[model samples]
Target: MREVVLVVLQLARMTVTDLLGSLNLPEEHIQYWLNRNEALHNFCSQNETCYSKYELNNKQCWGYEASCSKKDSFSARKAKCTKPNSWQKQIFKKQADFAKLAEVLSTITPICVSNYSEGSSLECSSHLRFCRAKNIFFDFHNLNAKNSKRYRNDVIQKGQAGGNCNMLFNEAALRSRADEKSYLQSWAHELEHFSSYPTFEVSKRQCDVIFEKPTVLIKLDAASSMYHHFCDFVNLYASQHVNGSVDMDIDILWWDTVSFLAAASPKPLIIHYARNCERASEPSALATVIANKNCG
Candidate 1:
């Protein structure tokens, strides 16, 4: 039975962690399998081949190179882990991935886009007023699995993962006084989330549903229906803050796969930004043109 679940997880392109808690496996048993079973360890390690240096932590496994910490072990604990670029990226090839996302969106929703906050943040979807004021966070975090000093010890990194947005980067220290003043001002953006391996739930309208083809990298599938779920969740979340109304102006941005989803479906108004493309000297506007038709 346990072997059956493990096989299913691999087929789903998921980690043992995905099946760990639900399996009713005891802690010691699971750990021993993960640490002692060479084949099992090897399988878990292959799950992250596409992560960019900016996306990994420890980076030590034979094939994988990232560190993970759940406030404590056990699948129930709150911890952080890293994910590579979606497998879909490899299957479609970046250019084709963007085209497919754009093409799919064109058939449904509207789109909009904007440049990311120059010295963006892992803090929240938007630039925090205080963050911008203190000039503490600059750009994004990208670390090599091979290096430890690359990551800020104080700022806990929650790789963009499931739960409403593609990733909710929660700074571990925010809950404590280590960075009090800034924490208070930015608390508005703080929200707890729920997640599985490739999916995260935020609200009815918002879903960080990472997509996977039988043999492809994960990609955002922002078809109109799925995005409708995201917006619906956002709207529901807004009701509590907006005095009984969800503002249409509040927008959601896509980080990594935003471009990919944008290209998959074109009819929908789904705007997105691609900073690396511009900086990568890779023809910056390639994605902008695809998402522009629907962007506000």
Candidate 2:
């Protein structure tokens, strides 16, 4: 497994020394590799392309058009541009697949039609299909082109506005600050929250077809921060009840957040903390650690 991981990193043109420095591995483990100078030299010599551009290091190559440095390998430059594009498609597909699953779940379960015809309640009922189906109500707001400025001014004057379970998605804010890929990622973050409905859990086997495996794996700090917020909310709500009573219905919210972040992280570091947060007997401590680590 170590060798396979190393090979993948090498192919991506990442230095093993840099990888070791980033990780919390022991000094002895680092020494073991350093001591094997002959073996290491042979390995690197056989995979010279991993360390340098080799045959493609010349100015004629596409990657060398701007910089003729050997460090700017053809494969590395190609990978750098293509990896993000690939992940963007994967993230968008993941959101679409989850939306389909939510639609299927809504059909199987009973939906509670809202009596209120005009307002945030009605909007929430329409957008959050499964949530309303379960008789769980929440406010939904879309701060778009027409309302973004007014909403921001109101928020500044009255302080941050939100209600219990309320979801406020600012499409304009996301568009103004984030690029297309990041915007899609933000949508994926919201879709993850919607997929955590209890009705979806009842059909776990069927849902597994779409949700079991990750479609994308990348380190997204925004997505990580969102997951941390979800986790923190769960822990805070649980603490409000006497004797640490928790509503099991809401467990899916944070659990799905964990799953999404685990899949989204480039390494297993966030996954490790997320799993620990999930299993901890007490709240706040482990969850706080994860929130601090990711949100920082």
Question: Which numbered prediction scores highest in TM-score against the true structure?
Answer: 1
The Cα local distance difference test for each model comes to 0.23, 0.23
The C-alpha RMSD of each candidate to the native structure, in angstroms, is 23.6, 22.6
Which regions in candidate 1 have their CA more than 4 angstroms from the true location? 1-252, 256-273, 277-296
The residue-level lDDT of candidate 2 at 86 comes to: 78
* Model 1, span 1-296: residue lDDT tens: 11100000001111233332232333443443344233445544554532221122332221111132222222212122243334643333223221222222222211111122211112221212111010011112232212323112222134321112223334342333122222222212211111123231212222112112111111122345766445433322221111111112222223232232222222233221232211110000111111111221
Instruction: Give a tens-digit lDDT track for model 2, residues 1-296.
Output: 11100000000011233322232333333222222233333443455542352222223221212232324322333334355557754444334221112222222211112222211110111122111122121111221223332102111111111111223333333233222122212222222222112221112231111111111111223344667546544323222111111112112213122234221123333221133211111101101111122112
- How accurate locally is residue 109 in candidate 2, as Cα lDDT from 0 to 100? 19
Residue 232, model 1: Cα distance from true site in angstroms: 4.1
User: How many steric overlaps does candidate 2 have?
Assistant: 0
